[model samples]
Target: MSTFGVIARREIRLALRNRGVVITALIFAVWFPVISALGIAAGAGGDAAAVAGAIATIILPVGVFMGYLFCADAFLREKRDGTIETLLCAPVSLRRLWEGKVAGVAVPAYLTTLLSAAVTIAAVSTLSGTPVAAEPLLFLHLAAVVPVWIAAAAGLIGAAQLALGMRENQILGFVFIFGLIFLIAGLQGVVSGISPVTEAVLAAVGLALLALARFIAGKVTKERIVRTIP
Candidate 1:
């Protein structure tokens, strides 16, 4: 019954009403994992669990994409539909509304990802020949942190959409593309040493840029509105 929870539920209900959104999201969450696992299992003809690890790579990009997609829709949709003004008229603070929107999408998308992972595991076990050694402990670690990463990525996109409006083409597109670059960079560093702090700092920098973009967008939008009202 908390404000965040209420707002989250409300947003979720809205998303649910859109069959396309729900179904498409479910496809992203499930398809890649299942297909990758099945392919590796069948090709290698080895342990089913081992094939699941290969599918984890698919989760990484999908997670980033989902995060951005969710956040973008959350904020941008409100603005497009004039719901933002109505929400602002309510008791919800700007920050709280933002937080609620993040949760609204992240929670459901993440749960779908989890279910997809389960399905992948089962299918791989039956269909794959690769050794499947997915440790329960490792899964726990991923589950705990992946959501945070997704939230961060989504928040950046939401902020961009809010602040940049029609001008967001370059900025939002760059950030979205940057996620892929970051992943590639990380892969390149696989053989080299990487500090935990460095990783955290990089993530912090991305979030900071997102916050700055949002602030700038707000100012620009407000100025444009004021100018038009002559």
Candidate 2:
């Protein structure tokens, strides 16, 4: 097996051994759908599309939140347990090490989200009494999009925890990340005059910032690093 695969196995194994994490994830997997069903029943005024959109909004955020929890633990617990130093001393590139940790943590979180989403969709169909036909292509789209979003969120959180060793830094990192999310969401609501080119430019800039965060974390794991200029 490749170095990344080995590290990924170890990380996943450690995560699986944690009963609290498993139980919490299971609870989320079950409750999210039930809540969605209740929401659908309470507010289904015959608009299937609106119901679907609302369901997506609620479920996607929950997924992202779960991804954050999965990663928050993964990033910090390994180092806390003294395994990270051993892992880092191994014959593996920093990039591959980071990649493995990301994959190991992200896979389960994404899977949990997918399962929760499926359950929620089914519940919506049942409670709304609407014959919901899920287009295969739409399902495929969701399957692709959900993971990417989760991975992106996980990457942000992992990079934050890695770069910022202090608890205050982690809190600030989360504040900034969520602040950026809301900022972008707000911009989307008010960007009638913004050109597509500008939007693309902004996205590219954001991605570059993430890349820089990764780079800095790999270089200096001791001090907290935060970007002042976007």
Candidate 3:
């Protein structure tokens, strides 16, 4: 395997072994979608528009939040345990290592979001006694755009964790968690307003942000990382 793959697999193994974090993230991913589906069934009888809207408003944020949850294990916990120092000494570029860690966290988070989406549709269909289907654009959003958004979010958080001190990471974690809460609250108003054009625009922006995160992560030097180590 390539160094990147090796690093990513290692992180994946570690993430799975962290049953507490994994279970908590999975529960969050599953619970929200089912609750949202219940609301959609009651309000809109699980119509396609309602289904699409719920998927749009809920899936992206949930996926990103999963990234946030996993990133603590991928970056911050490793740093705290002093394992990151060993990785830093390995024959891998900083950027590659960062990318690997992001991928490790993002893959599982994205899969969990997929599970959320599936449970959401199933719940809506069951509650409404009618088959609910997502719009094609919304399907694309879930399959393609959502993963990119998750990766972008993970990359940014992981990079920040690598570059900042523990106190700063704690603050960032609080800000990130609360920001997602506020984002979810704010999106409730737009559940029925999401359009394909909006999804496409968000996808484009996610790509840009991911690239920007890569650039920022690449700038984190060994000296800086070592200095930040407690």
Candidate 4:
């Protein structure tokens, strides 16, 4: 396996082992999507497009939240356990380590987001008592754009956690929660009438953010991450 794949698999295993983290993420991924799906579908009252857009909004924040949460395990837990320092002493470049961590968090988190979307789709369809599907643009947003967005968001969070002190990481956890709330509230409003234009705009933004994150991840060094640990 490639270094990135190995690290990602390792982090996925570690993250799944955390009962609290797994439980929390599972609940958010499963329940909130179901609830939101029901609410939006019922509100949209048989409008498949609106319901789909609304479902996308519900999962978007959840994806970001889950990414940050999993990243805590990948980035901060490694630092706290001293594994990061040991790895820093190894022959691997810091950039590869960072890349692996980002993928580690992003992939699983995106999977959870996919689950959220799936659950939402099923629930909304069931509630509507008919086959409901997203518009092409909205579907693209959920399947393609959201995953990239989640990766970018996770990369940024993991990099920040690696570079910050424990105290700041604790603060960052709170920031993530509040940021999630903010995004959910704001997104709920704007996603109702999602158009191809909206999808294109968001996709562009996501790709741009992902590029910036990759650049920043390459710039981060072992010295920077290790120095931040308490």
The alpha-carbon RMSD values of the candidates against the true structure, listed in the order shown, are 4.9, 5.7, 2.3, 2.3
Q: Which tens-of-lDDT digit does each residue in 1-230 have in candidate 1?
A: 99999988987777667677677878876777666765767664473333444545445456666666555566667666666666667786556666677678777667666666666666666675433434542264246435655666665565555555545534665666476548635752552222344334445554554465445444444343222221
* Candidate 1 Cα misplacement greater than 4 A, ranges: 42-52, 129-134, 167-174, 177-230
Using all chains and alpha carbons, the TM-scores for the candidates as numbered come to 0.71, 0.76, 0.90, 0.88
Consecutive 10-residue window with the lowest summed lDDT within model 3: 184-193
Q: Alpha carbon lDDT of residue 76, candidate 3?
A: 77
Q: How much lDDT does candidate 2 score? A: 0.63
For model 3, the stretches where C-alpha displacement exceeds 4 angstroms are: 177-194
- Order the numbered candidates by lDDT, best leading: 3, 4, 2, 1
Worst 10 residues of 1 by lDDT: 221-230
How much lDDT does candidate 3 score? 0.79
Q: List model 4 lDDT by residue over 61-136, tens digit each.
A: 7777877777776777877787777888877777778777788777778887888788888888888864556367
lDDT of each: 0.58, 0.63, 0.79, 0.74
TM-score of 3: 0.90
Error of 3 at 52 (Å): 1.5
Clashing pairs in 4: none
What TM-score would you give candidate 2 relative to the actual structure? Answer: 0.76
Largest lDDT belongs to which candidate?
A: 3
What digit string (tens of lDDT, one per residue) describes model 2 on residues 108-136?
Answer: 88778877877877887878766444433
